[model samples]
Target chain A: MEHKAYLDMELLRFTTAGSVDDGKSTLIGRLLFDTKSIFEDQMEAVKRSSEKKGIQHIDLSLLTDGLKDEREQGITIDVAYRYFATPKRKFIIADTPGHVQYIRNMVTGASTANLALILVDARNGLTEQTYRHSYIASLLQIKHVIVCINKMDLVDYSEERFDDIVRDYKDFAAKLDIHDIRFIPISALHGDNVVHRSEKMEWYDGPTLIYLLETIHIASDENHIDCRFAVQTVIRPHSEDYHDFRGYAGRILGGIFRKGDEVMILPSGFTSTIKAIQTFDGELEEAFAPLSVTIELNDDIDISRGDMIVRVNNKPEVTQDVDIMVCWLNNNPMQLGHKYILRHTTREVRAMVKEIVYKIDINTMQRQEGEKQFAARDIGRIRLRTTAPVFTDPYRVNKHTGSLILIDEVTNETVAAGMIV
Target chain B: MSHYYLNHLKELEAESIYVIREVFAQFQNPAILFSGGKDSIVLTHLARKAFFPAKIPFPLVHIDTGHNFPETMEYRDWLVDALGAKLIVGSVQDSIDKGRVREETGLNASRNVLQTTTLLDTIEQYKLDCCMGGARRDEEKARAKERFFSHRDEFGQWDPKNQRPELWHLFNGRKNMGEHFRVFPISNWTEMDVWQYILHDNIPLPQLYFAHERDVIERNGTLLAVSEFLNMRGDEIVHNKTVRFRTCGDLPITGAIESTASTLEEIIFEVAASRQTERGNRADDKRSETAMEDRKKQGYF
Candidate 1:
């Protein structure tokens, strides 16, 4: 394929998680190398490191060991992002550690990903770690889940073994609320069906992993049916060239937007029409999901950075009682009934945990109903009441409008990540 | 096109612009670290788009090592004039003469490391709380783990393992009075993405980026330009070659690759086919496996 073709493809961000010895890093290394994403000097450095360790072939996983301790211990200590592009798509792979203690890293990486790649060893089928990773992926509302049953070579690429693992995963996944699930048997060490067709698995007749990542329909993933825009900054040139240029600049959270569309700002509830959508150039006729543009309103209604703009009739819920799926990010336990900063879209309000309904055990997919104290790496259904009403929607509808972060007042550390539900 | 969903470049651009604005709203005093390289150039361009009509609400800070390519300096002056923004240059020569830093002596001695002392001094001298850089994660493995809002200690050190938890689009820039943050707006961009955005925006770059003839010598398999600061060995011979710089830093250490890709279009094509990483020619990064990580830890931008 032509290299320019890769430039035109849409981008996708995804995360990978598995146990320590499940060959997660090896799978990523093989995908990058087989796709020609690894450069010559990088390969040479990896080769040198491998030779120093008395290895004959290149230890592919060593390529991503970026930190000093990670290289010394041959393990990933934190979330390391790796970028690669095929002819049909651009990808941002967040390689996260799978140890139980690093569960916060997994949540952080998977927060922005549209898909999650869960690696399960073929020999082990599904273990406790597998269930933990899968549950976390589902709880994050990742639309697509691609389960790669790796190390098939060690298991002799048996069809019966693959079928049994697939059955178990199906039974487990049915209990969750994941939208799309797929199973692929792959030997990440041998580079089978990653970027190319594998003749060893003659019984398999599915697209390669790269092919699925490229062709999977993601356009329908965004919530375009609802119109939402949060004003980030107000642009006023006050110069000779563009003396009257006033634009409300922010990222499009959802829905389709265009020039001459009627819009309204929240809190003030002032209504106006979009005159011209301006970028660095001049003006654009239309804009859509994830595009940041400076919008010109017909009326110069009072608007600031932390204001919301949406369709006048189709508006989000404006209340202080916000039900959320909260994921604790810090090592400290969440302080209940304590005021913390709640940041959503462009607005910031003071909020506190009103109630902790239940905590979900990631490994068992069971809810602990009686649990009141919440700790790090724990996900629970919580009720948050903010000081000021924030305009928001359910996370299932729009990720941008439905997501928020809780900031500790004293240390200024982000303590919890929540999805409005 | 039916409702043109943003391609990769647009999405990356949108996210960067969002981060830039967040820094502006969050920090009381912020400045962009402009090295006149492609990454910084792209960043400045994005900042312009981030706050259109309203001049960028911050200044452009350049930590000069007194060993820059003549073209980069000229480009920096022109951009400052064009953007109508303030340019704050932190000079290493002044730091050396004032005994704030000492100059290294040897065949391969460089002021690259000394620039950090001057940079941290400038950050404190001006009371700039936030220093937005153009560093990218795809450039090196150490950079791959950097946060969007990277906090530095009071003494200016990077603790990769103990960074603040950055999630969603929220950036926490709050710190102690003496402490500051090094915010990378282009943390997610790759080398290819920077070039493509430059081409798409028709942003002018330094002349050294295009094919030019220059006197250089092969040092450690890298074509280092012959300069007053660069000490030539007895066996090394200087020759003029048609070359272009993939990245520009101190002239003595920054190597140029032989190429015929003069225009932006041709350069993108050449980069696409090239097997070596863009940082391969940089002598600073080649010193050790942890060269960048170590320098970053010591507050090198």
Candidate 2:
């Protein structure tokens, strides 16, 4: 096996979801602390804050609950991003508050996560909040789910209790669309089965959480068969050195784009051959998903921002009507026939909510009919008719090309996050 | 074929460049907030690559506190001239002289907090709809929750709890008139990443970052560099110490640490092995537990 250097390691972004007291923050704090990501100054500050608040033990939650109101209320109000890395891979944790009311924040956090860490208390087993979060993980098309049975010390580190909770969770998660579900029994507070193996759980045999995170096969998570490049902007350097140079600059959403490959531009339907893939360092032979590069074409096609370049044979669905699953993010309820600015990929189009199919009861995973009003944190299926054609694919196929956001024209605030169906 | 992937530093640079380009395409008027710090210098370099062959589209806005090291001012001028980019200075000294803000009178007074007023004034005066900063999430706790495209209200106040949800590569910069967005192109880069990038790209930095012999005084465990703007206190004796600044700010409050690492490689190694964060030496952030959060709420860059 070829050894990978620390700098060349791939990055893995994951989301953690747990109830208010499920030790989610503690788990993250342990990961960061054990990995030496937390510095002495930050730890000292955390200690000082703990002392000032009259807390006995250092509140690890203080490390992530950064807002003043959150620190006062002792609850996470928004999505806080935390980064730590092992030698094997770089990790980014989207720590989302696990409350039924903060579903929008969870969705926002989980939208880009490759894995979802769902914490379950050994004493309490699986609760409605767990199911809701798991359903969200499934809805957002998160491929991997790790059911961490936390606080095993409270249950005396019994293997039988771990088995029971795993069984219960498995039965409930059978309804979810998630694959690659793994179970681990450990105590986040005591640092068991996290970065290091716990001697107490002798009967339990599995890789540690950090080990699993570092070794997960995420290279295939992206869709490499479909080539999608949404032009974000045009790089036109009319300088004397490189005058008349026009390059399309954007990040490759999926698949591989190589020089000399024939591609077609969307909406305009103009075809051209890729002349070169350029970067600041130099030109490349090919580029793949998630890489931001500039491409020069042989033909001077009248292409601009919001246009997509793809293979001629493979194409995304371009239509005016789009079916979507929306999670409302604003205080105002989503009204039918209300116009909004829909931002998909790099294109923006005016869209109207034509109909609300049904609202899903997140706790029970049942569709609730006769609900016309969609309030904040409401997840439902809706039909939208756009003023112009938007190129898209199914959310399950390509996350980058399938997702969008709705902006209220009056306030220009993003009101809803949508996944195309 | 061998599997190909970008190293961490290259990936961060690409992401930042992409963001800088997006700002150019999305906003009507955008400017780079250059602070003469390493992070801002890296941001300026990324902007240069983001629009290579063409001069940087946006002007560089410097919020001058008038208490900077001479080395920093000289480096800033040289960089702006070399890049051939427009420079706009927002002077805190001018603000104080015009009675726009009051200067601090205490022994430990700093123009750090006062820079916010000059920054807001400059933005309003220039009608800058978008201002790009070099803030990283790893620097402070409150910054961890900041979005790539941070929105500011008409009054330029940041509501940390009510930030817009940023997903994937989709960033929403649309806003009503009189409101602007503060875009951070390198929010994910860490101190190590910054040093590694500087080393890899051979990016030029101010001389203060490298270790050198300088007159300093120990106060509250922080080494205060001897400068004209820094007021000497009684019972404090000046001593020549080989030290280097972890961060650049107003010379009065910005602290330096004793280090022998002079070269970029040695600095990188030292930073990698250091126990405390880079911002630990900044006296401005030590004011309170939630000092950065409070400053961010009031539109402090």
Candidate 3:
């Protein structure tokens, strides 16, 4: 490929959640190996380790399980990110363990993923692991999901078996709040249909796994309908050239922002027209989600960090009490009535736990009501009272403005992640 | 059909800028850990773009090992002056002089490990709550698992086993009084992406990154620049070879690679065709399987 092609290539960030039994590591290994991403030295190191351990075949997990203990135990304990590229796109894999206890790790990996990859053993179709992974993907509002029926060689590469699993998965996923679900049958260990089209499964007509990864429609993954720009900081260049330049610098979280568009400043409720969208490259006609730019307003307004710039007609709710689906991320249980530091959009406020509505059985999707205690990795619905009114949209409407993380006041650890309901 | 979607480079640039802005808003005191390397140069450039029309809001902190190449020092000084930013140098030699850290003794001994002490001391002295670094996740295995906002204890130690979970763009920068964060704005960037961006933007880099004739010695199949900091063995031989450094660090431990490529374009070509990682030449990471993990646990950058 030409060097210029690298510039045009799209970047796809995806997360994979599955147990070692599901051949998850092998699938990842296949992706890297087929793409020739694993360098000779890295492969050599893995070979040496496998030889030292007297393994029959090279263990692909060693490439990803970077930590010493994780390699020694032959299992993944935390989230590990792996990178690879094809001619079409650059990929970042947020690989997480699928153990029931490591739900926190899986959630961390899922938070920023544009797509989720859930592996299933072909022999066992649509198990609890599949449901858990699918549910988390939906809860995190991941738009796309790819379910790979791995270890097809063990099931004799039977088209009937693959179709049956796909049918079962579709039936279960119909209840999920996700779209763009796809399925592919492959043997990760045998290198069938992962990067290469499986000749054995010629009965299947879908694209290969790598093809889907490269061509999937992710241009619309971010929220482009709600105009939300969280002002991170105000840039006042007290320099000779930019003496009069006072620009609000931030990353646009939602819809497109055009020059001369009427926008409102939150908390202050002041209105201003965008004078110019400034960047290091110069002025832009418009700005959209994920671009960090500076905005010069036609009128002066009281704006600072934690303040937001949104389209006047399309505004997020400004309120103090919030109902949320809380994921317990810390080792200690959630403390009721204790003040926690709530970090939203660009604002940080003190939060008091109001009440626990119900606990979610992640695997079964059952709601256990009136449960107040939440241990590590527990997901539940809760109400919180922020010391100050927070500007937020429901997570279903906009992931950027709705998501929050709670930090323990004393220990200073990020204890919980809350999705505004 | 333009979809308002950024390409890979623009996306990466936006991500880095977002992270930089977060550090500024979240922390009272933050600084960029500068090593005068190309990565740090890219970082400094990104900081400029991040706060554009204005100067960088944070100081550029350099843990000077006193073993830097002359070209790197010149570049460092010139860049600092150009940016009009504060440059704070924490000297490893000073730490050695003050007995805060002891120097090692051997033919392969380097001040690479000693610089960690000076770095932590600098953070403590400056009361820096956050130290933005240019370290990429693709550089090393230990770093591959590192969070964008990596948490360090009051002792300046990193616990690989237990770390805060970073989700979405919502980075938890909360920490206790003495604790600080090491933020990597370019954590997702690869070596190829860095070189490609430099080429596309015509960014200036040190001549060291390009091919040049330098005095070097071969040891264990890698070339080490001949400098006073290198503890030469009795039987060692020095030769003039055309080489360039893939990574710049303490002149003693950072190995130079034999290359005919001189310009940014040529370097990118070499990088795309090269098989080894960027750190394959660094002797520090080759020490053990988990050498980086061990160093990171003890607060090494």
Task: Give lDDT tens digits, candidate 3, residues A23-94.
Answer: 999899999999989888888889999999999899998998989899889989889999888989999999
lDDT of 3 at A68: 87
How well is each residue in A324-368 modelled by candidate 1, as lDDT tens digits? 999888877885676788888888889988888899887887789
User: Which has the greatest lDDT?
Assistant: 3
lDDT of 2 by residue, A88-186 (tens): 787888898888888888998899899999999999998988898899999999999998999999999999999999999889988988989999998
The candidate with the higher DockQ, 1 or 2, is 1
Task: Place model 1 in a CAPRI quality band.
Answer: medium
lDDT per residue (tens digit) for residues B87-124 in model 2: 99999999999999999987888899999999999999
Model 2, runs deviating above 4 Å: A1-4, B1-4
- Model 3's C-alpha root-mean-square deviation from the true structure amounts to 1.3
Clashing pairs in 1: none
Q: Compute the lDDT for candidate 1.
A: 0.87
**What ranges in model 1 sit over 4 Å off?**
A1-4
lDDT score, candidate 2, position B49: 81
Best-to-worst order by DockQ is 3, 1, 2
Cα deviation of B270, candidate 2, in Å: 1.4
Residue B167 alpha-carbon offset, candidate 2, angstroms: 2.1
